[model samples]
Target: MTKTIRTNPLFELYIENNILVINNGEDLKNNGHIKTADIESIEFIRELNFWNKILEVTFGLIVSVKSEYVRIRFKDGFKDLLVTNCDRKKVEYLVYDVNLLILKTQNHHY
Candidate 1:
């Protein structure tokens, strides 16, 4: 399955055939593919500041576009975002599925 992670104007990230596909949003420099074999791990983040976190817990709500992010970290210590400005809960599952693909790919499971 091909899952689109994010499609912001700066960059886009997706998973296709178990590979991380970087479709540079509207630009042309960042398009590329990352195999599971090349990465150390993937990380999902709720990029909220102190006030945002407080607001979320206090109000039982979150700002989707401001709080969601996914980070793809390579073995080389460089990190790339799977794009930003994401929706809450939705992007969480996408990140989870991407990690599953990473596991399968790294394990040579097809």
Candidate 2:
């Protein structure tokens, strides 16, 4: 089964076919994926300042929010961004699980 975490309409996360995909699953231009074996680390950054956070938390109830970003660093020195706009705690928990899934996928293949 495919696992998914929706942070943004465009910046969604998926774990399927031994890959970590970051996209809305339809936007070809935004569709980016890193092989489970190639992921070096996944780090989250919050850019939502007080005003931005207020805007995001309140406005997000009716609109899209773009405040957090998950930076996926690859072993080959390349990197990708997964912009998120959800609750900080939820995103943190989900990313932590993503890290675990990455390790699990790598171990399974080995």
Compute each candidate's TM-score over C-alphas. 0.66, 0.57
C-alpha lDDT of residue 58 in model 1: 93
| Candidate 2, 1-110: lDDT as tens digits | 33344534534566677677666644456576667678766877766556767776877743334456667767667554545544556556656877887778677877
Runs in model 2 deviating more than 4 A are 1-11, 25-28, 48-66, 82-84, 87-90, 105-110
lDDT of 2 at 3: 34
Worst 10 residues of 1 by lDDT: 1-10
What stretches of model 1 exceed 4 Å from their correct place?
A: 5-12, 64-68, 87-90, 106-110
In angstroms, how far off is 69's CA in candidate 1?
2.9
Best by lDDT: 1
Tens digits of lDDT, candidate 1, 1-110: 44444445544466766577776665466678877667767777766778878888899885554544467777668554544554445556766777777787767844
In terms of lDDT, the poorest run of 10 residues in model 2 is 1-10
Error of 2 at 5 (Å): 5.0
